[model samples]
Target chain A: MKLYDLELSGNCYKVRLFAALAKIDLEIVPVDFLDGAHKREPVISLNPWGELPVLVDGEVILRDSQAILVYLARRYAGQAWWPEGAAQQGEVMQWLSVASNEVQHGPNAVRLVDKFGYEIDKPQAMRLTDRILGLLESHLSSHDWLALGRPTIADMAVFPYVALCHEGGVDLSPYQALDQWFNRIKGLDHYISMPGL
Target chain B: MKLYDLELSGNCYKVRLFAALAKIDLEIVPVDFLDGAHKREPVISLNPWGELPVLVDGEVILRDSQAILVYLARRYAGQAWWPEGAAQQGEVMQWLSVASNEVQHGPNAVRLVDKFGYEIDKPQAMRLTDRILGLLESHLSSHDWLALGRPTIADMAVFPYVALCHEGGVDLSPYQALDQWFNRIKGLDHYISMPGL
Candidate 1:
C-alpha cells in the first residue's frame, strides 16, 4: 500500500502508527503542504480534501486519518488493533469521532497555528484544549485503552497530537491517567515515529 | 436501540438511515438541539461532547453518529448495509470519512446556514461545495455506491447533505452521474425519512 503523507502532521501520523500496529508495511510518499504540494493535481487526485495520509491500496484510495484507521483495522481483522463485536466496534468509532472533533480542533489546530506561524487564536484554542483534556481525563480514569479494553486504532488516531499537546501550549499535566494511558498505548508492539523526513 | 437525534441534522439522519437499512427498529428519541436538551445533564452525561445522534443500546451509549453506524453494521453483520470483506470495508470507511469532512463541512454546513437563517459566507462555502461535489462526481463515474457496487452505511452517512445541497444554493447540475447515484441510494428498500417529531 502507498500512504501519501506529511512529515510533521499528527493526522498523517495516525495512519503511520496504525500501519505499524497492524504490521502493514506501506510505501510513504511525502507531500509538502508548505510548498503547496497538496494543492497540486497529482496529490488532489488521491484525496480531494487537500489533506495528507491518503492510503492507496491497489485500486482503493482512502482519505481522512480516522477513516484510514477504521479501514486498516477492518482490513486486518482478527488483529488486536480492530476488535470484532458490536460494543467494542462502537467504542472504537466513538473515540474516532472524538479524535476528529476534539483532538483535531484542539491541540492539533494549535499545532497548525504554530507550525504555519499564523496568528495564534490563543483563547479559543485554549478553551478547546481544556474541553478535550477534561474528557480524556475522565475516560482514562478507568480504562487503559480507548476501546474494547485493548489498544485500538481509535487510540492511535487520537494519541500523537494529544501526547504532544504541550508543544501546542496545552499542558496535559492535570490528566495523569491520560498520561499513563498514553504510555500504555505507546508501549504496544512495533511502534513508529510520526513521519518526519 | 434508541437513537437520540435532531430531525434536521444530516449527521443524525445518517445514523437513522443506517439503522433503517440494517432493518433495525431503533427507537427514536428526539433531542431538541436548539432547546438545549442535548446540553441537559442526562444526554451530556452519556456524551461529554454533548453532540446529537447518540445511540444507546443497553450499556453502550455511543456518542457519534458515525459510531452509531459502526454499531448497527457490526450488530447486524448478516446484512449488505455494510460490506462483508476487507477491500470493500476500506471503501466503507473512506466514504464515512468523506461524510465527516466534505459532506459535513460542505452541504451540511450550508443547510445549517439556511436552516438557522445565518448570513452565509457564500464564497468560502462555495469553494467547499465545489471541491466536494467535484470529488463526488469523479468517484461516481466509476462506482455504483461508496463501496463494493452496493448501498451501505457509507452512502447513508453521506447522502442527506449531498441530496439537499440546493438549500444552501449549491447547484448540483455539474455532477450528473452523482445525481443519479444519489437517487439510487435514497430509493433503497428499507429507507426511512429523518424523524419528524
Candidate 2:
C-alpha cells in the first residue's frame, strides 16, 4: 500500500499512527504541499479535493484520513481495530465523526492558522477546541479509551490533533484525564510520532 | 428504537430519512429546539453533546447522525445499506465524513445561520458550500450514487443537508447532476421528507 503523506499534518499522522500500531507496511509517498504538488497531478487525480493522506492500496484508493483508517483497519489490522458488530462499530464511529467534525474545526483548524498561517476563524476554532476538549476530558475521566473499552481507530482518529494542540497555541496541561489518555496512547506498542505532536 | 429529533434539523432528518427508506421503525421523540429541550435533562444525559438525532436502541445510545446511520444500516438494515467488505466500507465512509465535515460546516452551518439566526461566519459558510457543491456535482455527474454504484448510507448521510441548502438561500438549479441525484434519492423506496426540503 502507498500512502500519499505529509509529515506535519495531524490528519496524515492518524494514518501513520494506526499503521504503526497495527504493523501494516506502507510505502510512504510524500506530497509537496508548499510547492502545490497536492493540488496538481497524481494527488489531485486521486483525490479531487486536493488533500493529503490519500491511500492507494491496489484497486482501492481513498481520501479522508478517517476513511483511510477504516479501510486499513478492516482490511489489514483485523477486527480489533475496527470491529464488525453493529453497536461496536457505532460506538467507534461516533469518535470518527468527531475526528472529522469537531477535531477538524477545533484544534486542527487552529493549528492550520497558527502553524501554517492558513486564513481561518481563530475565535471559532478556539471556541470549538474548548468545547471538544471539555467533552473529551469528561469522557476520559471514566474511560481509558475513546470507545469499546479498548484502543481502537476511535482513538487513532482523534489522537493526533488533540495531542498536538500546543502547535495551535492551545494548552493541554489543564486536561488531566485527557493528558493520561495521551500517555496511554503514546505507551502503546510500536506507536509512531509525527512532528509537532 | 427511539430517535430524539427536531423536525427542522437536517442532522436529525438524516436518521429519520434512512429509517424510512430502510423500513425501520423508530419512535420519533420530538425535541423542542426552539424551547431548548435538547440542552435539558434526559436528552442531555443521553448525549452530553446535547445534539439532535440521538438514537437509543435498548442498551445502545448514540449521538451524531452519521454514526446513528451506520448503526442502523449495519444492524437493522443490511449490507445493501452498510456493506461488510473493507473497500466497500471505505468507499461509503468517504462520503460519510463529507457529511459530517464539509456538509455540516457548509450547507448546514449556512442553514443554521439563515434559518435559525446562528452566529456563524456566513461568508466562510458560503465559500465551503460552493466548494462542496462543486465537488458533489462533479462526483454525481459520473456516478448515480455516492458509493458502491448503489444507494447506501453515504447518500443518506449527505442528502438531507444538501437538499435543504435552499433553506439557506443556496440556489441549486445550476447543478443538473446533483439535482438528478436528489431526485434519485427522493425516488427511493419508502423515502420520507421533512420540512424545507
Per-candidate iRMS values, in order, are 3.1, 0.5
Steric clash pairs (candidate 2): none
Give the DockQ (2 decimals) of all models: 0.45, 0.88
What TM-score does prediction 1 earn? 0.85
lDDT of all the models against the reference?
Answer: 0.76, 0.94
Native-to-model Cα distance after best TM-score fit, residue B19 in candidate 2, in Å: 0.7
TM-score for chain A as predicted in candidate 1 = 0.92
Reference-based TM-score of each model = 0.85, 0.99
Candidate 1 lDDT tens digits, A97-139: 7776667667876776776674545555677778888888888
The DockQ leader among the candidates is: 2
The lDDT leader among the candidates is 2
